[model samples]
Target: MIATSEISPIATLSMQISAVLVWLGLVFLTSNILHRFKQDPELVRKVVHIGTGNVLLIAWWLHFPTWLCVSAGVTFSAIALASHYISVLPMLNDVGRKTYGIFYYALSITILVALLWDRFPEYAVIGVMVMSWGDGMAALIGKRFGKHTFVHMGNKRSLEGSFAMFVTSAIVMVIILVLANGFRFRDLGVVIPVAAIAAILEAFSPGGTDNISVPLSSAFLSYLLESTL
Candidate 1:
């Protein structure tokens, strides 16, 4: 006869591992399909970025065990680091730049999920949302429509890109706030400043560290200010 406690642990481990595999498999499969079709590398990267960050939403909605989210973050972070040295996922790392954005991105998710999952899951979602949508849009729009350019902290950025980040970040906050707290206009007090700061962090963070800075700052600021309100 087997003990229920033993069975419970086994079940949990199996579920978490399966979820991680599915999540990672989908992202990689999509990226490879896009790569096969000769799609833009940058576009494929952004798709992976946005799609990867969104797993947090599934974790949040399904109330996944904290260990699951943390483990997923750690696993992805390791894979991102490994991909840098190998052509394991060329589409993700062949962006023609020397940046650790993907690694930092996975690290940020790990940190945020570890810190905010139990106490403030909503803030975790907000953080990932801002980073994924805000930063992703900035890169895409910046590359396509960015004409007026200036250098900030050794990174060339356009007014257009910065605006995209700010606007998307603000909208992301508003949606999260309304869903989490039932649509209060006063939430703008938190949204505007957090969005502005997230943009600044994304702009100034060198070597793609904005993946860490923007999301952490956005999540913490949203939590701190929202607590006051």
Candidate 2:
């Protein structure tokens, strides 16, 4: 892996610019296209949710500097916050809905990148992917196929949704572990517990805070468990 410092100034700038373009293109174009088609706003939200999270893959592949990732997170968190009031990302925030999922999502990314990018980026990937795939799929599946329901902290959730979260979290954890440590059955010790914890957190967290709780817990727990192995 080429160190970020060794890359020439022009190359670094180019990469940063490319990152910005990709992110903006994804957000703006998706919102506009979904709006134009008059698709379900929820669909637009989920598409953006899953799509934007893939930027982490880009960051990981490109070896984005910690500051760049953190700055993007902070910037988007601010945008998400502003979007709560103004109609600034209509596809993301539903009108008159009290949910800060988008904000928490960005903040979690910021926190994970700041904490783990330098020494353990794979953990950061595990964290964000769990949130991106796990929670995103849980919401989608819950909305579509959530037949059995229960309420927690005044928030209703479906068993199907929770199961989706757990399964996705486990799959994400396993994939990252396999990529990072090769195929090892012992990693199941890490994947199972961490995925269960992620599911628990997602089920209990109310008002979309699961975005923060799920990823941070999954990543850090994975880190701790892997250390023991």
Best by TM-score: 2
TM-score of 2: 0.91
Q: How many pairs collide in each candidate, listed in order? A: 0, 0
Error of 1 at 204 (Å): 1.2
Candidate 1 C-alpha lDDT tens digits along 1-229: 1223445676856765666569868987888899889988888999889888878876676566687788878988998888878876778866678677889999999999999898788899999999999999998998899999889767888889999999999998898888778989899999999999999998889888999999999999999998898
**Candidate 2 lDDT trough over 10 residues, lowest sum:** 89-98
Candidate 1 clash total?
Answer: 0
lDDT of 2 by residue, 137-174 (tens): 88889889999989998777899999999999899888
Give the CA lDDT, 0 to 100, for residue 183 in model 2. Answer: 94
lDDT per model vs. reference: 0.86, 0.84
**lDDT against true structure, model 1:** 0.86
